[model samples]
Each structure stands twice: as structure tokens, then as C-alpha cells.
Target chain A: MEVVDEGSDGRVARVSLLRTPLFEAHRAAGARLVEFAGWEMPVQYEGIMAEHAMVRERAGLFDVSHMGQVEVRGPRALERLQWVTANDVSLLADGRAQYSLLLAPDGGIVDDIIIYRQQADRFLVCVNASNREADVAHMREHCAGADLVDRSDEFALLALQGPRATEVLGELTDTELSEVSSFAFVDATVAGVSCLAARTGYTGEDGWELYCSAASGPALWAAILDAGRDQGVGPAGLGARDTLRLEAALPLYGHELSLEVQPFEARLGWVVKLDKGDSIASAALRQARERGPERKLVGIEVPKGGIARQDHALLDGDRRIGTVTSGTRSPSLGKAIGLGYVEPQLSRVGSEIAVEIRGRKVPARVVALPFYRRPD
Target chain B: MEFPDDLKYSKEHEWVLVEENVATIGISAFAEHQLGDVVFVELPATGDEVAKDEAMGVVESVKAVSDVYSPVSGEVVEVNDDLPENTELVNDDPYGDGWMVKIEMTDPTDLDDLMDCEEYQKFCAETSG
Candidate 1:
């Protein structure tokens, strides 16, 4: 690699570690560090492909402490959350988490979040690290009687994902994960660390997300890692995290789902509840849903030769049709896979398109969502 | 850390093993380590002509894509066809089966301007720090 000297300013202030308690442990395990969302996080430890393969075949642990967690409590919590998020919170049962979107008045997505109803008067919302402050402010502004509190500093989040994740996590916690269905959470303890363990993950695998205090995070991580040593619980990084989520066809905050892109255009209509009473952006969502999105998100697969990349022009012969939003050479599929916005007519599966790769148009076909799916 | 004393190095991290008019090119071990598990390689055509320091090809890892710079002006001769099917060879055996291309050098004198193994190693050490 060409090492360019983008010289530092030399102002040696105390560089904050946007760290979980496992920060030092990760460094000790030989993780290559990179800056991500204002935190110095590991991009990969062993290698991307190795870690990715491990997760697919066995299990993997991911430090997702960089994600923001906020608690909304009081009698009006559910009502206030319904006003801010696109999904109806009244439908969510206690200990259940629902994926929803916070929208601007124009029906564009502010941030896609997961709202976990902890109790009748309390709910926890997990948001993107970069958009945490904005999400908090947005919720606070819209909330009338509910108390909005940012608990990101008090808690650390860890995702144990893969097929063997249940076996690994089951060894540590007393609670039976089999009793908890997908998207459901339970308050439990692992190695004496008070944790809220949920059966949810971003990797499209069977996994559990553990939220605990900052001081006890490292101990919990170590205990799980130790328990899962024989099960091949590799520590995954942001590199595999991106590829795995992309292969699963999950919409990322800044990519497929963005402030300028409506939920309908992003193919997240399943999460938007239109008939659940009037709320902010509900009218706009209804209008968008009725008319149908002008542009729709579609999965693209390049059969041969070139890999389609982000910003690559999508073409129908000579006519430029759309642009690729997220693209990568899928390690699992062994082909170039991408997600892009195309005209609704061209978004059908099996529809042929072309992607201009290095000035030459390469053949691509619109494929089904999720290039890879884990076996349930 | 291993640099062959007989090879010439470029600032872009490509190492050239020159034999008469033909030069074999591959990224150095240091380069492969930094790039981390090369997932894709865009090799040039066999007949394509490239200029000194021009974009020879592209190498993609899981994280980012980097442009591979041509170390010297030459006519494209033989590209490593195995790379597309097995890009991880660049990470495993970067200087052997992982060699990207073999180019017929138009000007052999250009080799003199490139860094030697000792100088290149020192350059890498200084730059990484």
C-alpha cells in the first residue's frame, strides 16, 4: 500500500476511547485499529474472510458498543414513541423489540432504530452511532410528558451471532434462550454481570445481543469468549459486519436508508405501519405508499467478469437507469452482489441491467433480496 | 519485512523482478499486509499499454479499493489469470503465485531510479511510523 503522510496536528490532547470495557482486551487480541463513527474500533482481527466464514460456519462475537442506547420512560412513553417513530409502539409487547424508522416531515428517514419495550412505562431505543445525538434531540423535541434519557454511557452492547451462537450463549447465562423468540429480550446475568440479553442481531444469523454496564462488559465478553472457545467464537470486526449485513439485505443508515430516501423507496415498507392512527410523517407515508415509490431498491447480481461498486451507473443498454448504493464481491455467493435504486419497472427479479465498470458496461441482473440466507 | 535484494521497488509498493526486457510485478509483503486479504483484483489486458506510474489495475479488500500504479512504462504481456478466482493468493503468497503481471519493459533504464531493497525497507519503516 502507498503510505501517504497526512501529517497529524501534533496537539496531544487526551484522545477519548469510545470504548467498551473490552477495549484493552481487543487490542491485546491483535485487532487492527481504524476510526469509525468517532470511535477507534477494530476493522478486523484475523482477516475479514476468515472471521466472516467463522460466523457463517460457527459463531462470532461483535463489539457494538458504539451504537447509542436511549431510554424513554413514564406513562406517556409509548404514545411519545409512536409520535416520533414510523412503526406503532402500541403493538409491541413488553420485552419485544421492533425495527422502526424515525422520519423527517417529508417522509424521509432520519435514522432506522430498534425500539425495545422494557415495560409498560419504559422503552429502550438503539440508534446509529453517528446519528445518536440527532435521534435523541428529535425524540426529546417530540416528547411531551415522557422523560427521555441518554443511557449510552452507562451501557455496553455486544452481539454474539452465528448458527452456534445459542449454544455458546446458553453455556454462560442461566436463562433459556429457547424460551425467548426472535426479537424478544430477557433480563439475565452472565458471569454475575447484569445484562439484558435479546435474541436479535444485524448479521442475519441466530444470535443474542447483550447490554450491560460499562464496568462489567469486559468480564461478560471474556466469559462468553472462554465458554465459546471450543465452538469457534471468533471476534468479528466492522469489515465482516458490513459484508454480512449487506448479504442479508439489511438497510444501513447512511446507505440504503437515509434522510433523503423514503422508507418506501428503501424497500422497508414492512416496518411502516400506516393504519395505526395518525402520527408525524404518517400522512406523507400514506401518500408515498399509495402512489408507490418512483425509485425502488433492488438487488443486483453481476454474473461474470467485473464487480459493481458504489456510485456505478446502472444502465438499460445506453440509457442510464439508476445508481448502485451498496456493492461488494460477496464472499458467500462468490459473485459481485449489489443493492441499488432503479425505476420501479426495472426492479423486477430476473430483469436484466448493465453496470458501467471502468467505462465498459457489464451485464447485471436484478436478483431477489438477500444474496445469502442462514438456515433456520 | 522481507524484501528481495535483487528486486526494484516503487513508491506505490509494487516490486519488480527484472530479467532482460521482461519484468514481473507484484505487491510487496508490506503492501499485502496493509491491504489485508485481497478479495478482488482487476488485472489489465494482455495487450494493453501502460505508462510509468499510471493506473495499472485495482485491488479490492473487504474494507477499501486501492489503485495499483504501474512501476514503469511497458506493454502488457501476461496477467495473472488465477487472481480473480483466488484473490487471497495476494495475501498468502504475494511475491510468488500472487504476481499480478509480467510486462515487457520499453525502457530498462527506468529501473535505476527505483529504490533498492535496503532503501525500500528503510522507506517503509519510516513511513509506517
Candidate 2:
């Protein structure tokens, strides 16, 4: 939230990064902090691979308080939401959330958001931290007299994710977390702290995203850690989060979904509901759906050699088809995996492709969207 | 960071244990800490020839990728085959079990150009500080 220092001319003056409420906790835990999206967040605590394995086999805690939240409250909230977001917000019942996209008129993504229908007339939208200011400004213009409030600074968000997450969190909350299905949420007191717990996560795991008052972050974090210490619940940072999400094939805002990348091209067409009525980018998305997207996002696996980073060219012989959006050495899969946009014909699973890394074309192949899925 | 007194060190943070003509090479404990949880390692073939200060292998960590340079030129006689399967060894026991390659040095005199434990420690502190 505090990564930018603007000069009088509106230019970026200096990198005066902001620290989250859990900054002290992270420091005390001996975390490696890195500047990400204008926030000095811990990229790793113990280590990425160890933390990643712990989350998959046990449980892990994440400080995601840097992410932005905006509340749209008014009688016309649904109308305003429908007019701006690409997803059909009407389908979301109260206490439910849906992953949606804020799009420009040309079908380009402004930011990927999670819209929580708190009530018939009140919605809470969670957005990427990097796009907080822009997202708030954009929504303000289209709020149509609705109460648009930036609530990012007021809450400290925590994600207790992994297989044992429910067990760890259940010890502190009276709410039956198991009853809350995926994408559902409830208001409850956790660890003597009143918080909003949502059954949603970026990691492909069963977890809860808890939002509490900024002042209560330290106690809540300590209570959860102490409760789950024997269960192997350790603190994780953004580094493990990135690898986990990449393994699940989730799209990050700057990496996968960008201003130049449309949802159709990102293989997120399912979220775009043309029948939801005349919403932002609906016409263009409708045309894209009818005709077909020029490029489609697909999973690319580098069987061997170097890891493909963002912006690396996806090549078919000498011609460039597309570029890598997000990539990492999957700690779960034991191989290199990446998400990238390529020609629709080349998007098929098992299609052969190559990623140009440092001038050499590394052999790769197309796989399914999600490289990893939790065993039910 | 632990830099063994008996080993020769490179400014790049590699440590070499020279026994006659064959030299065992590995990254220092300081280097392993900085890299953070190595997931994958790419080692040169056993018979591949490497020059001093040349990039000989790659270490892919969860955070980023880094090149492993040869401290002394020679033919790679042996590589830790267990590394590709258990890259965590590089972090667990960087100086001992995590030794990357054993090279038959083309010229053992190259070892004199390297730093001792005290010098490498000072180098790490200066750079890290």
C-alpha cells in the first residue's frame, strides 16, 4: 500500500515501501523481506521449498493484509457491480464469493477481483495489492452514487492454507469451518478476535482467508501459530504463495492477467457472462466468444534445463507464438511448469512447443490448465 | 557463515578442497543461505572440461536461478549424482555432502589465486553488509 512516493509532477519519486501489520512478526521469525507491489513483504520465512512442502503436508500461515478491499454499499450496489465486473454478480448469493474480472471497454483486464456478496445491497471486492489505487479510482468513477470505500488499511488479512488448515483454525473459532463450502464465508470470533473467515485461497488447498481489524493482527497471528505448532503449521511468505498458485495454474494480475490480455485469451472465458447484460467489456467479450480468441492461455512444461521466466518467448521453430506469463520449478510436481499464451491451435494438451530462454530454445510441451489438483 | 579453514575460497563464494591434482568444489555455507532452498541443480558431465572462472553448472532455487562457476580449471572427474535427486543437500551440508564436482585440476597453481577462510569471511561480511 505504501510502495510509491509521488513527486509534485505525479511521477514516482522514491521507493518508500509500506510494511504490513505483521511486519514485526515476520521479522521476529527471521523472514527474508522483499519489495513486492509497493509493500515490503516477507518473501520467505524458513525457506520456500520447506514452507511449500509444509503447506501441502501440514499447514501454513500467510500475511496477505497488503491486498486491497473496497466496499460497494448502496441500494444500487448490484446494478453498479453488474455494470463494471465481467462476471455475473447476480449468480452470487449472499455470503458467497465469485472470482471475477474488472475489465476495460475493450475487454482488457483492469484487475482480477473476488466479489463477495455480503448482502443484496452491499458487496466487498478484494483486489490485487499492486492495482489498489487504480482499482479504487476506476470503481469510484462507475460507482453511480454508491458508497465506495477503500477498506484496505482497516483490515489485516491472514490465510491459513493447506491440508491441516481446517484442523488448526477450528481450534480457535466457534464457527463450523467444515460447513462453509468453497467460496463461502461467515462472520465469527476467532482466537477471541472478531474476524471474517472465508473459504477461499490462492493455493490449491482447503483453507480459510481471515480478515480482522488491523489492531488485532498480532494476537490472531500468534494464537493461530501457537495452536497449530504441533500440527506443523509454520509461517510462509509470498515466495511459497507464488509457487503454490503457479502449481495450481492460478493467474496473477501482472504476470498472467494484464491490461493487454483479455479474459478470453487468458482461458478465463467461463467467468465472462455475456448474458449478464450490458456490463463493462461485455460487447467485446461477446464478440470474442462468438468468433474465438486469437490466443489462449495454456500450461507449458519445460521437461529439462532452464526455468522459463515471464516475457520469455514461446516459440514454434523460429516463429514466436506467444510469451510465458508465470513459471516456476513446481516443488510438488518435481519439474518446471509455466503458464503462457499461445496460438489457439498450439494450446492443445500434448502439443510440442519451445520456450526461448537466454537465446536458446528449450524443449517444452503443452499440458492441462492446472498442473496440480488436491486429491479429494 | 562457516568457511572451512582448510579449503580455498573464490570471491564468487565457491570453496575448493584440493587434494593433489583432484579438487572437490562446492558452494560455501554463505552462498547456500543466500540462494534459499535449491530445488533443481544442473551439473556438467563427468568428463566435461571446465576452465577456471567459467560457468560450469546451474543451481535453480525456489527464488531464482544462479550460475555455479568453476574455481579452478580441470576435467570434471566426478559429480554428486545424488544432488539432482536431493538438491536440498546443497543447503543441508553445503561444504561436505553437497560437494558439487571433483575435478582433476589442469593446473593446481590456480589454487594459490583463491582466498583463505579469513579472507572469504571478510569478503562475505563486506558484500552482505
Candidate 3:
């Protein structure tokens, strides 16, 4: 593909200080580059669907170094985190990670993050690349006397995901990864680089996310690619990443879960603990649980044809009910699937709906969440 | 990319091969490369009248959807039905198997305004850069 010099505004400058160790490697590999959140990231390498299928069938590598990694240290770190976040952090043990949400005073979602308990006093929080600065600022404001450190620049993260990911990564390390359960991590080394291997990923596949130093990232990435070459592990970019996550029904920050939407409305009530010993949003969550959400997030599957895109109007007969938040033509399912907020009464499992695509109403059904689930 | 000297080209990156009054229309190699990994193609039906430089069909890729323009004013005589399932033929053999439609040209003199292989190559190079 030919590189066209297209310039936009200073949107890259206003976000955060973007840093990635694999910028040169991505560019050299003929990746079409774009500014995502402050970082210049690869949108596609060979093609979107090809990489998307590879991650579903075999293995794919991703330079997730752009995601923010913040460390909270000190004796009262866990206690402080539990008060500020919506998840029950007391249930987490050392080396275990939990998906949690940072909530505002009114119970709105600030950001969705994965909290990894490294030790009793130390925790690693991985947030979206676009919300890094705001997340850090939010953490500092809630920390009070706790030690809050932004380790995003110092560390680089890589995700090796798919069915063969474990086989490829296990060959490189001396430690056996067979015992590591899902959402559990182990401290180890890869190619002499000190790394933390987590058995967690966004794709609905068995995989590991390796976090290492920024300087050692390039070598570690090359080593993994070299080791997994025969096993069909290829470099994947943001396009595949988006499709994989969407198929799994994961909520993206700007799309499903945002500061304007509450966790209850987004159907993430499981993460928000209402009885976790008096947080600021506890009373509000309790009230929300009692009344239930007016609008609920649901999955819609288009049966015949047409693709449902963002901002497309969803209807029941002639009455407009809601709008699609995220939608795509699922390459795996060979059909169009989307997520949208609809009236709670109409958000049932076999509810019929219509999505207006290009002035035509396509038939769709509100099916169960997660249009695709990985076989265990 | 090679543009055969015998073929005629349109500004919208469509090529025309006129044999008497029957003209075969397919997108240029540049167009196929630009719209990577063609997933779905909407073809014009046979017996449909098409205007010159007008949209005759639509091609969808993973990234974007583009309209395929007709190079000559004519009636669609035949359409490539294989492209609906195997749209990647556009990327593989754009000139041969990827021919979108066959048209019975209303006016064969319209081919004179189209570019030859040399002129089309230079036009693509200058515009692409």
C-alpha cells in the first residue's frame, strides 16, 4: 500500500504523550499508520479480515504498548482503591486480576480498567490509551496519601492471542503456564527481559499478555514472532482488535461505557458493588438497583442483509426506539451484529426490531449478549 | 501495474475493452489495490440501461464501500455473478475474471475520449502521488 501524507488537526497533541517502542517496526512492516489516542498505531498490516480471522483460528500479536499502566503502591493501596472503584477489590488475591470500573460521584462510569494485584501493597491498573491522563488524574485525586505512579512510559505490553498462543509462548519460558488459571499472572523473563505474563486477553481465545520494559519490547516481540512463526502467529493491528472485542461483546470506552452512561445502564451491574462497606456511589447504586435502568444495553443480530453502523436509528415497526452504539458485519458469523441501548421492556431475548440502513429497514432480533462465545 | 495498451480507461479507474459494440468493463488494478480485500459486490442486472460515468454497482471492502462507475452509456448485456461470493477475484485477476459487466454500447465513438495504456499509467502516477 502506498503511504499518503494526510494531515489532520492537533487532535494527537491534545490527548496524552503517546509512546510506543514498536513504531519503527510497525512502519517498516508496511503498516498503514494513524494517530490513535496520542500514539501512532497500526490500523492494518496485511488486511483487517485476514488478521481478524488469524486471531480467531491461530495466533496474533498486538503491540498494546499504548495502553496506560498505572501503579498504586503503599500499605493502604487496596483499601483506597476499593473506596474509589466500583469492584470488590477485597476478593482479589495476589497475582489475580479483576475487571473493574472507576465511577463518578453519581455512579457514572469514569473508565473501565483491569486491576492486577501484584502484591498486598502494590496494584497495576491497565486503562484505555485515550483515557490515560484522565484516569491518572482521577486516581491521584482519590489516592490522598497513597503513592500513585504512572508507569505507562516505562513499560510496554504485548498480547499474543488465539488457540496456539499458549503453545508458542510456553516454548519461550522455563515456567510452566499450564497451571496459570484465567485472570492470573506470573512474573517471569522473556529473552532476558523481566516480564509479567497474564493469562488474560480481550479476544475470546486462550492467550497471554506480556508486560516488559520499553527498551526490551522490540526484541521480545521479534522473539515471540520467530518462535510462533510455524504456529501461524502473525502481527495484528487495531482493526482486528476492534472486531475481536466486538464479537466478544466487550464494551469499548467511548462507545458502550462512557462517563455519561452509568454502569447499571450499560449492563455492567456485576462490577459495581452496592454493599461494599459504604463508598460514595453506594447509595446511588442501591437506588438504581431498586428501580432498575430505564434504558438497557442489548445485542441485535441482523438476519438477512445490510450493515448497522453507529448512530443508525433502531425501530420497532414505525416507532423509533433507540440508536446503535456499535455495529459491524461479523466475519466469523457471516452476518451483521450490533449493540444498542433500548427500552428495558423491549430488550428481551427474542424481541424483533428493525434497523434503518440506507433508507431501508432491515429485520433484526435482540438476541443474547456476546454474539460469539469461545468454546471452553 | 501494467495497463494494456489495447484497453481504454476512465477517470474513475474503470477500464473498457471494446470489441465491436460489446464493451467489457472492470476496475483498474489501482482501484482494486486502493479498496483492499473486496468482501461483497453488488452487480447491475442484465437489461438495465446505464449512463456513462454513472454508478452501476457498489463494492464493499473491510474499510470502506465504493461505487463502481460505468465507463460507457449502454445496456448491461451480462454481469459477473461469481463476484458475489468470490470478490477477491478483483484483487487477484482484475482484468480477466474480475470483469464487472458486459455492455452493448449505444455509441462506440465515446471510447475515443478514454486514455490508452501510456496515458492512463501517467495519470495514475501523477494523481496518486
Superposed Cα deviation of residue B80, candidate 2 (Å): 3.9
True contacts kept of each: 0.53, 0.80, 0.27
TM-score of predicted model 2? 0.92
Name the candidate that leads on DockQ: 1
Clashing pairs in model 2, backbone N/Cα/C closer than 3 A:
A3-A38
Ranking by TM-score: 1, 2, 3
Model 2, stretches more than 4 Å misplaced?
A1-14, B20-23, B46-52, B73-78, B102-113
- lDDT by residue for model 3 over A1-376, one digit each (tens)? 2233344953333343354999888988888776777678888898888999999999999999999999998998988899779999989999999999988778888899999999999999999998999999988888777799999999889999999998888888887889999999999877667899999999888899999999999999999989988988889998788878889999989888888888888989889877678775787788888889988899999876567777888999988988899887787887778899888888999999999876779898999979889877
- Per-candidate TM-scores read 0.95, 0.92, 0.88
Docking class of 1: medium
Q: What TM-score does candidate 3 get on C-alpha atoms?
A: 0.88
Quality class of the docking in candidate 2, CAPRI style: medium
Better of 2 and 3 by TM-score: 2
TM-score of chain A by itself in each prediction: 0.95, 0.96, 0.94
Q: How would you encode candidate 2's per-residue C-alpha lDDT over B1-129 as one tens digit per residue?
A: 677899989998899998889999999999999999887888899999999999998887876888999999999999999998888999999998899999999898898889999988999999776
Backbone clashes in model 1, listed as residue pairs? A1-B31
Candidate 2 residues A1-376, lDDT tens each?
Answer: 2345678898985667888999999999999888998889999998998899988899899999999999999998999889899989999899999999998888999999999999999999999999999999889887677889999999999999999999999999889988999999999899999998999999999999999999999999999999999988999999999999999999999999988988989989888888878987888888878889889999999998778888899999889999998888899998989999999999999999999986789999999869999989
Tell me the fnat of candidate 3. 0.27
